[model samples]
Target: MFTGIVEELGEVVGVTPTAQDSVLVAVRGPLVTSDARHGDSIAVNGVCLTVVDVDGGVFTADVMGETLRRSALGTLRAGDPVNLERAAALGSRLGGHLVQGHVDGVGEVLAREPAPRWETVRFRLPVALSRYVVEKGSITIDGVSLTVAEVGDDWFSVGLIPTTLALTTLGTRAVGDPVNLEMDVLAKYVERLLGARPADAPVPGPVAS
Candidate 1:
């Protein structure tokens, strides 16, 4: 699991395709790989990928077909910056919400409005995922967790502080750029529970006389 907190802004060094429908991705993230080893999980742009090899400050991971189909990672190329975050350790503070590093869907930047202190960026929300987004709710975009500042039928906005604009990949995003999105897991769980029969509902007794 990840906390959706970006540890470093890493760059894609290389992308090599394999015989099967998979690609070997090498990323340069000094901070994330300072103590890294094989078999560790890293969240790259909101997708949880297992470390295949670690050399110097660079780490390589294989992106399978399913992940490519579901995320914006497939569109990445050498020199593209990515938000990087190591898995959250046990007993650590939950800085962001519970993030599975599982991309729910992909969205595109619709607009960006810069303010004196912060900026509000609007993104086109997928029709299927729009129901989960709410004003003031948490959402993860490209591995960085942010709060929903406004919501519409097919779009939502988030306020980005200077720190976020300077430290993460979102800072470089422009209109029409695609981003990976993961809605709050708690909302999905609540929806599931509400749709199912309640555990507290009494079983039907034999029709009373």
Candidate 2:
């Protein structure tokens, strides 16, 4: 699991395709690779990728077909910046919310409204995923945890501080750019529990005391 806290802004160095409908992605992250080794998991742009090889400050991971289909990672090319975070260690501070590094859906940046202290960026929320978003709720974008500043039927906004704008991939993202999104898992669990049965459905029999 991850904490949705970006530790470094890494750059994609290369992408190589394999015969098994998978691509090898090599990312350069000095900080993340300082003590890295094989068989490690790294969150790259909100998608968890296992380390296949680690050489110097660069590490390579294979992106399978399913991940490519569900995330914006497929569109990444060499020189693209990605938010990088190592898996959370036991008992460590949960700086951000629980993140599975699983991209639920992709969203597009609609607009960016700059302010004196921060910027409120609006994103086009997918119809299916819009219901999971709520104002003041936590949302993961490109592996960076952010709070929902506003929400609409088909869109949501998040305020970005200067630190976020300077350290993550969202800083350079332009209008219409696709981003990986993961909503709060707790909300989904609540929805599932609430929708488990119809209002008129009969409850199961209880044991005799």
TM-score to native of every candidate shown: 0.93, 0.94
In model 2, the Cα lDDT at residue 6 comes to 99
Question: How does model 2 score by TM-score?
Answer: 0.94
> Least lDDT summed over 10 consecutive residues: which range in candidate 2?
197-206
lDDT (Cα atoms) of all candidates against the true structure: 0.95, 0.94
Model 2 clashing residue pairs (backbone): none
lDDT tens digits by residue: candidate 1, 27-136: 99999999888999999999999999999899999999999999999999999999999999999999988899999999999999999989999999799999999999
The lDDT, on a scale of 0 to 1, for candidate 1 is 0.95
Tens digit of per-residue lDDT, candidate 2, span 58-115? 9999999999999999998999999999999999999999999989999999999999
TM-score of model number 1: 0.93
Candidate 1: where is the Cα deviation over 4 Å?
A: 198-209
